[model samples]
Target: MGKKFFEESELIINADGSIFHLHIKPEQLAHKIILVGDPGRVSLVASHFNEIESEVESREFRSITGRYNNKRITVTSTGIGCDNIDIVMNEIDALANIDFNSRQEKENFTELEIVRIGTCGGLQPHTPIGTYICSEKSIGFDGLLNFYAGRNAVCDLKLERALLNHLGWSGNMCAPAPYAINSDKELADRISGNDMIKGITVACGGFFGPQGRQLRLPLADPNQNEKIESFRYDGMCITNFEMESSALAGLARLMGHKATTVCMVIANRYAKEANTGYKNKIDDLITKVLDRI
Candidate 1:
């Protein structure tokens, strides 16, 4: 029997033969990719490149392929949230592993090395503003991975159940069941350091109610943050909150790629501290990732 092919509707290639959402041709993709939440950050990362080979921009997705320290790298913006991550990770893997013309999976695919450098809110006192937290594991409140098959193969069931029990999770709560996935150990080791605090990061679905922020609308569980912050598993405590790391790590694991996240702390939820002037810190983080990645 012939190999099963991806349907046109499912694996979309633009008329110009580029990935649908990312708008990047397969050839334009590099083996190494750095993911950032802001589209403007694309240029920031590319600035460090010795020379750029290509640049593509469409909607919130901006991509630039260039050389850093003589090594080829592609930096792409994912905008924000796990929803955007779903589009970015799939299209990225398709670019590396799927044959656009044949619409078939490549027999031997290139495994991508992906690192996400972003800004996040610190959940713990130790993870203060200006701290760099390497995500050893990401807890997903986004409920994204539950939709995908074989998620259990990549997720940490023990961590999931532990969190569920700690929070007394129930289907009636109208919240997604939390899931956990670890970063690529080798990649994490390369990008992390003594200066960076390594811990579990919670990736929330929204910036408001989902993250325990109050405006006019009240939170379903006002104490959700307290419960999350106090929960402990395998000697690791929740350290930070971000929007993208969970989906980035979970999807990459399923796609056989190496992925991890290192975020600079811009706000401390516990301490009620925030640093609006975090661009310089982000630049320092970019330098660290560019050098180590």
Candidate 2:
């Protein structure tokens, strides 16, 4: 590592040449990365590795790289939300494609294969608790992609327009404008193994307010859950709700990387059921995803 070229305000890197937030170097990361929302889950995924190589941690982000069945894989925790995804994705891409010493992009870019394995609430009554499903498309209510350029080209404009029209969306609504994007089909297919249910996933900005979970505060749209449950476009129904998949899929597509999400249905909102003992299910999902990826 040499003297820093990027400004501290623009791009922050540690003295050891690791990225600021992730505390990871380019060589430590693998091309195939597994992203989870919980820092504790990092080791859970790495537990399947045949041999451990490296481990790094910074704040809520934790990373481990090792060989899984002779295949190199990196597992990292992103904490939560598209907000966190913004930071993690950019920094990871920088670690892979940016020359830290020169503060510029490398001549040859690396396209990462990103897979998000997490837990979500099933919106549909049919998708029961403890079910594992892969997202075919993700609808984002977080508005992360709106801040970036060239979003229209990466988003599914037709689906967005259809959803807007169907929902009677107005500027007055408290919800942010929604954008839809499809997951990388190749990755979804591989992860699903034709055994999991594939449906649209909605990524909300907040767990309570945006997800229509009313506790102490009232929602602007009280019928948000009902609306989402009834929403269908191109024969696809909204299946589940989570916090990060939309931005993961959207930003990955914009960056020319392959991304997909496989989540365990821990709660069924319509069925009024929740699985308190979902650790075994999650472990099984982790094994399945690790085997595929």
Candidate 3:
């Protein structure tokens, strides 16, 4: 069978031959990529690079390619949600394996090693503020991966069933079904340390209702956070809540790439504590990832 061609609307390339949303050319990318949520953090990651080869900025997506410890790496910002993660993951894969000029798949494949470094609100007591949490697996409350075909092929079905049963999620609540995806074990282990807590992470769709943070509006399940905190499967408990990770790990798995997320705990939902001055902690985390990746 012949390869299918990607439609112009589906695979958008700028006139300058760069990816549409990210505004990054294929050559500017690196096999080792670090994803950050805030665009401002891209520069911080690049600062540790010995030599920066290229930098591109468009919309909330900012990219920088450089060398860290003689290994070429690219640091890019993905804004703040799984929706954005959908865009970033697909385009990054396309850049690595698609022929933009022909809009077709390349004969050879280029597998990427992607790592997401972000801040999260810790759910477990052990994951208090200033702690580092490496997501061995991510629970997707975002439902971004559900839209794609073969989602279950890349997901953890047993874990998903356990989570759904624990949450008592029904169709009537208009809640998105939760899914689970394990991180690339090699990548997760590489970025983890004795001080880091390796556990399940929740990738939420929204900040308020999705994460049990009530403000002006009321949540359908007021005890949602409590239930989530108590839930466990195969001795793995959900460690923290973040905006990305599930989609990154899911899409990367489906695309035959290595992906994982490691986050710094800036807030503890269990302890009701937050560290607003988390810059130093994140800097330390970045250095750890750079050295390991």
Candidate 4:
């Protein structure tokens, strides 16, 4: 037979009694999820967990579930960009919902709170290398959700329009696409820390030429990151740069799940900021965030 509808194949066992994808079932999750873009970082984050539970890996997807602050949670590696985010989010959605009979019409889903903890580049000089940015909103530069039905549903539409108007960003071939911010204010507020600097973050499409690195390739849009920082929606600011937060936030809101991303300032591109104790900052930031979350 072909692929079965409502099959939790990559979440629950299909062939035999086994956890699929990350090789974990719904019961393995802790309702609170912490995501990292690197598979190795999954274990790094889980090290802070109270109960050192099972560590499982499938492809770039590594998972460690345990307790922190007496709160149950799971840390999973989402690999690289929006494509990986798409996979991890969908699989996680499947894990949370129980559709054992393969039903299609019901739209069964269990709400889960997800937070992405990753490293990103600082767009503005104020966003120090040691700081963490909680996205108040994300600008979808990746077009990952360009095909989704409600593209701007998770974003600040007034902010988006204001940004476009302020930066005159509406006419470029790669126009600024809208992104979703976290819907739960309490969740966002509860997650912020000294290192957790919360603001708007732009989810770039690529790492090299797209993010404004010459890297031996022809230029499509040179000086784009600067242009990105030049963007503003009234007083609302775009804080940092990364690859996935926009789509993650957007899709999560579309599906009625709460999501946000907290990124470390590893590189400060403007003012030639590369390594001002960036590593030490990342190490401390990870420890602090994981301990609290």
The candidate, 1 or 2, that scores higher on lDDT is: 1
How do the residues 161-249 of candidate 4 rate in per-residue lDDT, one tens digit apiece? Answer: 77666555677656656554553566667677554677788787788776777877877657566777776555656788889888788
Residue range with the least summed lDDT across 10 consecutive positions in model 1? 167-176
TM-score, prediction 1: 0.98
Query: Regarding lDDT, does 1 or 3 come out ahead?
Result: 1
Q: After superposition, how far is residue 184 of candidate 2 from its true place, in Å?
A: 0.7
- For model 3 the TM-score comes to 0.98
* Native-referenced Cα lDDT, model 2: 0.91
- Candidate 3 — which residues are off by over 4 angstroms? 170-173
lDDT of 3 by residue, 1-293 (tens): 99989999999999999999999999999999999999999999999999999999999999999999899999999999999999999999999999998899999999999999999999988998999999999989988888888998888998888777778875546767888999999999989967688999999999989999999999999999999999988888989999898999999998999999999999999999999999966999999999998
Give stretches of model 4 more than 4 Å off.
1-14, 17-20, 101-109, 164-183, 276-280
Q: What order do you get sorting by lDDT, best first?
A: 1, 3, 2, 4
With a 3 Å backbone cut-off (N, CA, C), the pairs that clash in candidate 2 are none
With a 3 Å backbone cut-off (N, CA, C), the pairs that clash in candidate 4 are 132-197, 154-180
Best by lDDT: 1
TM-scores, one per candidate:
0.98, 0.96, 0.98, 0.85
Q: Please provide the root mean square deviation of candidate 1 (C-alpha atoms, Å).
A: 1.0
* Candidate 2 error regions (>4 Å): 1-6
Worst 10 residues of 3 by lDDT: 167-176
TM accuracy, model 4: 0.85
